[model samples]
Target: MIHKLVTTPMNLVIKVGEKVKEEADKELYDLPTIQQKLIQLQMMYELGEISEDAFKEKEEELLIRYEVAKKKEFEQWEELTKKKD
Candidate 1:
């Protein structure tokens, strides 16, 4: 028995691709959860979405949060590894 292949149109392919990207975006990255948000804010600043002062303030806040999260993640990983050793 021969199986026939169905060809997908370009528009359908693009729509499906976009939906897959949207679904993937819903899942959070494991490291530095706030990193993306920080970058987004930085980009907005670069794009002139807000004033320099406001951008600086938000950048500082996000950076501090990112550092704290990174440290906590490191500590937790170290503890888990130590247990295995």
Candidate 2:
């Protein structure tokens, strides 16, 4: 009983942390969010706020994230269709 009492709060905290991380990941890799960041990056480049090298590096990272987001969206759609069928 004492062990359960000690572990219960810890387990709850861990679960909450996992849930928060999952939500953060979803937002971070969201397609629209990535696209908005890309547009902002482009604007910065055009305004000469960021160097070409820095813009390119950030652009590449965002593009990679966009691709991953697309793939994940497709997979989720497929799963939903499979469930319906």
Candidate 3:
């Protein structure tokens, strides 16, 4: 009983922290942010701030991120459409 009492608060805190982190991550990696990041990467490459190899790597990473965000957005839209139908 004592152990359960002591652990319950900690468990609750952990769960809440996880939920907050998940939401924060979703916001952090949203489409517009990813797009802006790609633009920044391009500008960096053009201005000699980043090398061609680094630019390619970062661009690919951002493109993948954008695709993931787009996929999630499409899934959400499909869900809403299904609900309406």
For candidate 2, lDDT tens digit of each residue in 1-85?
Answer: 9999999999999999999999998987899899999999999999999999999999999999999999999999999999999
What candidate 2 gets wrong by more than 4 Å, as runs, is none
TM per prediction: 0.60, 0.91, 0.79
User: What is candidate 3's lDDT per residue for 1-85, written digit by digit as tens?
Assistant: 9999999999999999999998987876688888889889999999999899999998998898888888889999999999999
Ranking by lDDT: 2, 3, 1
Q: Whose lDDT is greatest here?
A: 2
**Cα RMSD to native, each candidate?**
9.0, 1.2, 2.4
| True-structure RMSD for candidate 2 | 1.2
Between prediction 1 and prediction 2, which has the larger lDDT? 2
Of 1 and 3, the candidate ahead on TM-score is 3
Candidate 1 per-residue lDDT, tens place, 1-85, comes to 1222334465678899999986654433234457788789989999999999999898888777667667767988999999999
- lDDT pick, better of 2 and 3: 2
Q: Is candidate 2 or candidate 3 better by TM-score?
A: 2
